[model samples]
Target chain A: MQKNTFKRKTLPSLAMAGPVSLWMILFVTLPMLYIIYISFMSRGVFGDVVYKFSLESYETLLDSTYFKVILKSIKAAFVTTVLCILIGYPFAYYIAKKPKEVASKLIMLIMIPFWTNSLMRLNSWLLLFQTSGPVNNFLLSTGFIDTPMSFVYTDGLVMVGMITNMLPFAVLPMYSSIEKLSRSLLEASADLGASGRTTFFNITLPLTFPGIFSSIILVFIPSLGIYTVTDMLGGGKVLYIGNIIKNQFGSIRNWPLGAALSVLLIVITGLLIYIYTRFAKIEDMEVL
Target chain B: MSISRKQKGKRRQELLGTIYSVAIYTILYIPVFVMMMFSFNNQRYNYYWNGFTTQWYAKLFNNSAVIGSLWYSVVIAVLATVISVTIGTIGALGLKKYEFRGKKFINNMLYIPIIVPEIVMAVALLIIFIKIGLSLGMGTILIGHCTFCIPYAVVTIKGRISGDGYSLEEASMDLGANRIKTFLNVTLPSIMPGVMSAAFLSFTLSIDDVVMSNMLAGAKNSTLPVLILSMNKTGVTPDVNALTTIMILFIVIAMILNNFIRNALKKRAKMEENI
Candidate 1:
């Protein structure tokens, strides 16, 4: 009986799950623990990580410069999330109301830009808004400004890049949720003599809260840690928490400080995800 | 009177919706369209439009560095897709089939990659690699890509496998087919769509990755995106624009082909049911 049970159940289960479990443990879990571990260690004078335990990295985070970047990153991420929602929610609603074939095609349209290299997309933005680029050229000829106004490498442009990069992530989840909403509920609301605006606010918006919540989680977290958009569009001038982390690991070579900042990011992510679980199931997260 | 007023309000709302969608889509696509147009411009600086020419495309083809990095990106993407798909599919199957201890923990573990920011994960992986004396190169890049991609594959495949119950597999087993045969004949076919989509997604992600690849890639092993990052810093040439246009066109064509094949398969399945 034991042999049969092992053969049919335990062995097959192990065969199936063992590889992935081992891979995750070794590659994913262990590395994550190592980051936490190294964050506590001291940085050597030569930019190497020393084995001595110290609280100096955490102390460095308390510096006003790092604190300001963290605040700025949070503000940037918040603004980006809000902008994505304001834009993506209505677009998702529009797509969800379309026929199934049309809705899928619309979704595909959104995804097409995403498939292109993100750096390429950011590059195009640079080309478009560069001092001598089309926008400035048009403005110069039309006499909008005497000389070309500098549009590249600004916080506003960085926000534009962030919105474009994150819009699809925000839209896809909301679209899925809004599509799942039943038409009968809307009709029932209308039949009960509710105004269209009322129906939307009370019925549609509340029902799609989970999607918006997930969208917030998706957009806010990544933008907080995203260096590429700010790096390219901000032109190395605007440093966020993400840029600081990159610098620490890159030019600064402060491994303990980088690891410490990453821990901060991880904590923020864990808190948001914890909040997300309170609102909805994690499995229902619409990543695509 | 009330009905006409209501109809007008509804019409106005729809018109607004249509206009909003059109404006949003234009915002999304304008940069891409502009990039494609400038790829053919005779101007090297891409400031003002000069006469159209294909010279940039020609130059891109001859650029060995761009071509080599692209090749490396493809190779890594393919390898990562294969590894993640195999591990993820099997793991999902195991979780679905067995009532095992620590199943919840394993499932939660899958969400870690999806939840955590890429920069943190990249730095984490880099630290561990340095600690273990593992040199950064294509090998480290592959590990990084697989680490993230596996969670996506697992989630996607699990959704498909769990949606359709195991009745067909059970029936096949009852008819004296062995477990391996049952899986091959029944379970695999049902999940093939999910598997294919997961593979495509994993490929796109690996190819498009910038943050992790930047950290994990050594000097000589930069992927296309990492290469593009460097190129941008040194002043982007028109050839990069040409390359971007080509990549966008290829992906669009591939997506359309995938959609076409899926529709045809669905039609054939419907006809089979009718017969």
Candidate 2:
């Protein structure tokens, strides 16, 4: 009986857990390890790893060009994060304040665009804001502007794209948190004679602080790393750290430098995630 | 009079809130709506609003490159979904059922795939693939995708598996149904929605992905988004718009179908409980 019991326990663990753990160890963990390993290796003359120990890649990170790229990427991501919160908080508030059915429907509306490929949305933005696009035509016809505005291929438009892409991430967590807020708490605040604004500040904001922080981390980290928006919307004239890293691997053919840049990104993401866990439950980190 | 004034104030606040909601949704969807509308434009360049035509849709349908990449994307998505979901379901069950060393650590590790930026994972996979001399192609792209896709599957399936209060497997074992039979008959049906949802989630994410796929894709095996991306280097056309609309429509249909199945399953469960 003891032997049978032992077989039962071991069988499930081996049969069920073994394949996935092995897959992750092979594909995910090992690949991440390889990235770190290569980050310390020297860049080969022919664009391959040279297998010699060197901090040249990390030194390259301190180069003025890379430093500027990293700084610019952080600024853009910070701007995007702030804008997402500014736009999404009120939107999430509106959703959470609605009846449950209406709220779910509104949430679904937010998600529909989210699930669609972001490249498509960015394409549409390009099309809409292209030279002589509808907005320019309307402004010209309405006498608002004398000529077509240079709306496409601008830093401003890239920021706009980032805001749209990251808005849902900000909204989902805040909305979920706000929905979990007890009506009695608000009612009690009112009963205690707090003004509407006072109640909102005291009761609503503090309660949803975790959601707000989660939104910040979620939006900020991806915005830092996602190059697609800048690549398409900025017309490749601009470069974030993502584009720089991508160029390193693609055109520059510097794998070690690319790996080093990736490690920096990983560090930034890890720090933000560590902060996020401190503020909120890990399970509450909902993007959908 | 004060109560009436308070009620009026609340009513006005609600109205304002509704308007804000509408405005937010409008900003969120205007680009997508514009694209969908422009997809039917008779003109290739979107400078002017030409009369409606299904020409772009027709052209897209006949476009060999678009069709080929789409087929490749679907094949990759389906395979990734099947593999990831099977692994995820099994892993979720294991994590829930078995007490083992590093269980807490494994649960925490689930978030790494999600928390790490896609580019980092993309570069990591690229570096590793090159180190191992695996040629960049669909195979490389598939491995890159599964790296993140497995974690997504685990999150979804594990949530469902753990949320249940009772263990049908334990009950079945008590009744002399063997381990395999209990899992097949009891546990499988119970978590079918989670499995299906995880499958859909992985499939959608895989199909819609661009960065990892682009980084890992070979010259001859461009996915549809990658194809569209290449086209964007020149300029996007209404045909591309039409293609996107189709993809969006396809996903919406898939989601609705999945939701329908979930609802039906819930209703059947309700009936079973009543009986």
Candidate 3:
């Protein structure tokens, strides 16, 4: 009777998990395998995949132009990461310090804009900063400049877009970690002879290191591979690593080269994530 | 209790903290402020304040393409949400209750989709759909969405099930209820918050997707984000601003309705508790 009951319970559990498991293996694992496989193949006369194995695609990736693209992408992503950290850390800190009810509401405010498509947000930025846009017109009216500033499609504007897109990803994780900090530690630091400055650098900063590390990883990796923001805001004038990958598939029609670039992206992301895991447990990664 | 020189230094540090806080909030809000202000602008160029007009909003609603694509987006989002939540709830419960092999692998699989670049996932799925000869349309979009959507739903519901209580379900079963009866009477109510939240989240995410929809869309199956993106590529238009205003209006209306219904239910629940 007990064995029958055990079987009954177990059967349902297995049944429940079965379909989702199969879905994952097929859609996720299989595609990942295909990416690796495509990375090894040669490009055909047309855009078709030629089955003959060759390292030509990987070799193409090693070309100096590719290196410059990778370096530029990294530089942009890095600058964006730093700005996000500077902007996000204290915003998170302020929110975390609020009462629970208020904190959630504040978090909602931060996230509400996010609910709108990111592309919409980028378009709005363009509308706001374009030559005839309000900022330029206002500046012109105020006698700040005789000519309208060419803000859109510039490096500065691209950085602005990148930072705006990534700010939320930086804040949410840091907020979770900072919120979990023990009140007594702050109290104890006060109770002792330590000043607020010493306590923060010595205690609070150290405690929040895990969160800071995650903020870096989350912002850096996505900023590296995100071509849409750069493509739209950069006016297709400047290319990030992401734009290059998109070019291969869309305009360049080099699937093997694209696959190789994607493989490189995957490696970079994996290595960073692995490093982040060393600093902060993956299980503790707060989903915003 | 000690206010020594060291404590003075700490107070100074806190002052620095205050400075840091102000600077950060300014950076975060300035762009948002610009966007919010322009939404109310009368002129087509957000750079100039011609005069305040709601004409953009009026024009937005008149756009047949935006309206049609929005309808399609809503249907696909709803379908994807329903499918993902059902599968996710069952999967979360299964993962929570059972000691199964490959649990680790399954857990990692879910995380991979969340962290991997959306463009990469979009391309990979597109290639696979072509390789397998799956017809690209609303169906492909729905399926592609669910592959990532179910993972998020699963992870969320798993956290919810693990927290709080499951004792009610155990007791209900002990009192001679069948498994289905126990679930209907106990498990469903317990996880309803999770279910609602997960559904809300999935709907929001589905509506926001551009890359995946663009990759998998049939010639006829354009979503609002895709339409907006194409229009953007052409150049700025007052129509987009108007369309955006209309979309924002829809979202605000939805939020207000949700709040009203939730408050009514909460009031009823409180009355019952008092009784």
Candidate 4:
């Protein structure tokens, strides 16, 4: 009887879980391990990865040129995250206060642009801000400037691109959190003679801290590793860690160095995730 | 007089909120709006509006490269969605229903694909492919997509299944139905909505992927986004704009339909519970 029950339960479970487990292990786990493994390996003269294990890539990362790029990427990512919160929080709060039907529609509106091809959106920014593009043309016609200012390839425009791409991700988590805030808590605080500012600071903000943190993780990490925005909007002029990693794999062909950079990103991700897990359950991450 | 003053203050706050929301929405949408509007603009470059025409839409069909890459993207999305949904649903059910060791480890592993940056995942996959001597192409792209997509599928399906207890399944089993039969009749139907949405999400993620697709795509076999990325370097014509606008419309309509169907199903389920 015990053997029969074991066969019935465990066999089916194994049959169900085995394929996916193997798939994840092979595709996700193996690749991740390979990245870490290769990072410690040395680079060859011809830009291929040499099998000999070395700390050369880690040493190369400490070089001032690469160090500056990492610092710049972090700065860019930090500014983007802060900006996303500042912009998204109000919008999320407003939506959360609305009736259910209206709130859903508002959320849908936020989502529509996200579903559109992102590269095309980046391209639109390029066209709209090109030296002879519409913004410049409009300004020139209004006699705002003598010449069209070059806007297509600048850090400012790249920042704009980054913010737009990451805004929806930032808003969704905060919206869900804000929406989940119980109204009675705020009402009770108000009844207790708390000022509106006091109620918000003491009650609402703390309640919504998980959402805010999730937004930071979602926005900051992607912005750090994003190269396409900088590549297009900055016109290859802006260099970030993401661009450096891409070039290492592409033009430079330094596989070990690229792997090391990726390891750094993974470490940053792991650290943020660790911090996030302390505040909120991993499952509570508002992925949608 | 004081009550009216408070009411006035509330009204002003509401108005400010409305204005802020509208401004943010406008900023969110302006670029895509510009892209959509330019698809109808009869111009070589999207700098100025010459005249409104749908010629770009017509030309888009004739652009073999666009159509071909689009075909590849659709194929990859479909395959990835189907594969991930099946494996994910099964995995979620097994993990949820049965006691198992290493469950926590598997659960943690699922988050890696979702939380890791796309560039990191792309390069990691690229490195592994090169190391394993697997040539980069559609197969590798499919593998990369499924790796990320399965976790999302599992999470989504897990949410649906975890909400309801196992009483119904137990009842079905006690009535002499085998486990497979119980799953077929009870478990699967309950999670249909989750499965459908997972498929939708996976499809969208697979199709819109540029980073992974670009890295995995070798000399041939470019997905639509990868093709578009390459075009950005050359010049993005109006046809690409037309294609993007069409995709935007298709996704919006699909989302509306999905929401409508989901609501209908929820109402039906609620009515059944009442009965």
Candidate 5:
């Protein structure tokens, strides 16, 4: 009877969980281990991985060209993240303060852009800011500049694309966390004669730290890996880490070097995640 | 009283906040608004308005490449969604119910695809596909999408199931219901919304995916986003804009339907409560 109970219980659980476990192990975990393995292998001349092992890919990373590219990628991602925080915080704060129905509707409005293809959106940015595009045309007609300034194919344009791509990510998490803040806390601060600015800094900002952290993680990692923005907006002049990794695989045809770059990207992601774990529960990582 | 002055100051703050929010929202929608307007533009590859025509939309429909890519993307997304939701929902149930040794470790591992960069996954999968002598195609892309999407399904389903699920399941089992019967009658109905949303979310992620498709897609099978990405290199055409506008319309209709269904459910539940 004990064995029967055990059989009934464990069987269903195994039948349920077993397939996914096997799936993850076979597809996800094993592939990642293979990447690490390939990262150590040498690249053949024909754009294939040779079985012989070496650290040439890692060594190549220390070279000045690769170092500069990595730094620039970090800088771009960092700037985009900071700008997202600055832009998104106030927007999220305002949305959270609205009535529930209105807030959900406003959030829906924010999501409209995401429902469309990103390429479409990025292309629109190019068209909007192109030399003879509307923004430039309007500015020139209004005599803001004697000539239509070069707007498209600029680093500034790439930055705009990055911030735009990531702003919704920053906003949603922060908004959810901000909405959860009880009104009584703010009312208590007000009744105590605390200035509004003082209450905001002391009470509100710190309360939403988890959301901010999540936003930072979400925005920073993707921005670091973003290649399309640079490809279209920057006209492929600037090679961020993502573009570099893509090129190594695409045009350069060096599998090991690309794998090494992938390994580095993973390390950077892992480090940030480790730091994140120190601050918040892993479950607190917001999907939206 | 000082109350009037405080209220006046508060009003000013609110006004400023309102203005700031409007400006942000405008910037966010500016691109889409431009695309919508441009899709009607008579000029080819022209951002400036020469005249309004739906030529781009007409051309977009006639483009076999766009249509084929769209069909491929939808089919792949559906397959990926079905596999991920089934596997993920089951995984969520198992993890939530059992006290396994590696439970904590597995939960942490679930965040990997969420946390690890997509490019890394793409490269890793590309290598694996090649090493295993599997030619990259729709199948490879499907597997690639499934890898990341499963985590999302797991997260979404787990959240739904973890809420009062243990109590509900135990209560059902306490009755004469067998395990399968309990799941079918009690748990499935309750979690149906979560599962549906999970399906939708996975579909969106898979359909919108560019990186994995770019890597895993073969010479013959290019998804819409992958096609669009390549087109962007040569500068995107207005037909692409038209295609995007149609996609946006579909999304809007879906969201509206979802909202109506949810409201109806809420109303029915409220009526039941009153009864």
Candidate 6:
């Protein structure tokens, strides 16, 4: 009787979840499978999928140009990640130590900028830094330069845009983790005669490693795949792996190549995520 | 009760804290301030502020293409939000309240759409859709959006679902309410906050999305972001700045309003406690 009653009660909930599960399997899992499959398929001259199995795309990935692009992507992502961490860590520590009400307000400030469209934000950066813009005007007026310095369409500008875009993602997780840290530990460490610097390095840093890991993943992965900021700020001359993949599908009409590139991107991202979760508990990485 | 060198150390730390805090806030605000100031610049070029003017804003309103794309974006955002919330609420409840085989696997699968690049998802769907003879249009864009939207909704709703007090549902069921009736009367109200936030998030995400929407939108149905992107490619224009400024203003106002309402409620609760 108990078994029957339990089945009756639970059946509807199971049914409720079933459709969503199927949808996830079909749309999310199946497409990922398809991407992997196409990565192995031969590319035809007409840019259509040729059904014959081959490893040509993976082989092409070994070419120097592709290697350079991948290296460049990694370097760019690394720089962006470093900048975000340096800026975000102190900001997060400050907010975390504030009273609860004040900390919440500061957190809201970080989030409010994020709520604005990322593309729009990128565009605004373009406007503010355009060669003839106020920045150049100010510099020229100060006699810092006789001519307006070329600002947009440069790698440095792209990095600045990327760092701005990703700063919040690094801050929020670290703030939460730092906030959760026990104050008594600091008090305990001071009592033991350790210098403040030593206490911070030994105690606070170790406890906050999970947040740092989250900041890296959250910043690095998106910075790797996002073409919008780079494309806008870098003036389409510079092509990250993301812009290359986008071009293949959009302008180049090379679906198979795009699919192959995507498969590679996914594989790299998945490996990183797997490594990250191993190093830091997945539950500890939740940002929100 | 103690006066020592430790107090001196704390004072130095506070002084250092003030300097760092001031520098960080300046870094955060400067770029945004530059953007906001240029919005009202009378000069056609952002390089010079000729004077204050609203001409660009006027031009933004008069442009038919911009208006059309904005309307379509709004419509798609609303539809996507509605569909995602319905599916996500059901999915969250199921995950929270029940146990089933392969549940862990299923839960992980939901995250795949979110973590994978949108270009990958768009291209994969494009290949499949073309193979099956599905034409690109509003329907395709909506589906593409929902694929990403569902995961976000599930995550938000799942958080709230786990925190809910379920005794009301148990009581309603014990009083001979059917499962569906009990869910409506007891469970639904408790989960409404999750649903609302999920819907809000989905709407914002859909409206801001350019990658998938750009891919899925056919010749007939270009989105606002796409239009702006092409305009940007054409070169600098004051009209684009005006449009972006309006979008920024709308988002900031919405956020401030949300915070204001939340603070007001908190103040009321404090007063009630005192009384």
lDDT score at residue B260, model 1, on the 0-100 scale: 95
For candidate 5, what's the TM-score of chain A, rounded to 2 decimals?
A: 0.95
Model 6 C-alpha lDDT per residue in residues B130-191, reported as the tens digit of each score: 76788998898988899989988988888887555577788998999988898888888888
lDDT of each: 0.90, 0.86, 0.81, 0.90, 0.87, 0.81
Q: Give the higher-lDDT candidate: 2 or 3.
A: 2
Off by over 4 Å in 6: A1-10, B1-9, B43-48, B163-165, B263-275
Candidate 6, position A77, lDDT: 91
Tens digits of per-residue lDDT, candidate 3, A92-189, equal 88789878998887787776667556776787678778888877889999998999989989889888889988998999989988999999999999
lDDT of 4 by residue, A154-270 (tens): 899999999999999999999999999999999999999998899999999999999999999999999999988987787778999999988888889998999999999999999
Q: Which tens-of-lDDT digit does each residue in B1-275 have in candidate 2?
A: 99999999999988998888888888889888888998898886665577899999888878888789889999999999998999999898888877888777777666777888899889888878877899999998898788788889988988787555546677899999997898889998888878988987899889988998999999888998888777777776788788888878887897799779978988999999999
Write the residue-wise lDDT of candidate 5 on B178-250 in tens digits: 8889889888887787788889889999999998899888888799999988887676777877888888988
Instruction: State the lDDT at B57 in candidate 2.
Output: 86
Off by over 4 Å in 4: B260-275
Tens digits of per-residue lDDT, candidate 1, B1-275, equal 98899899889989999999999999999878977888898986776677889999888888998889999999999999999999988888988888788778778878888889999999999989988899999999999999999989988898888555688988999999998898889898889888988898899999999999999998777898998887766556788889889989998887789779988989999999999
Which lDDT tens digits does candidate 2 get at residues A192-269?
Answer: 999999999999999999989889988999999989998889889878989988998999999889999999998998
lDDT of 2 at B72: 94
Better structure of 4 and 6 per DockQ = 4
Which has the better DockQ: candidate 3, or candidate 4?
4
B22, model 6: CA deviation in Å? 3.5
From the highest TM-score down, the ranking of the candidates is: 1, 4, 5, 2, 6, 3
- Best of the candidates, TM-score: 1
Output the lDDT of residue B266, model 2.
85
Task: Give DockQ for candidates 1 onward, in order.
Answer: 0.76, 0.67, 0.51, 0.73, 0.69, 0.54
Distance from true location, Cα of B88 in model 5, Å: 1.2
In model 2 chain B, where is the ten-residue run with the lowest total lDDT? B161-170
Query: What is the per-residue lDDT of model 4 for residues B20-43, given as tens digits with 9 covering 90 to 100?
Result: 888998888999988998899888
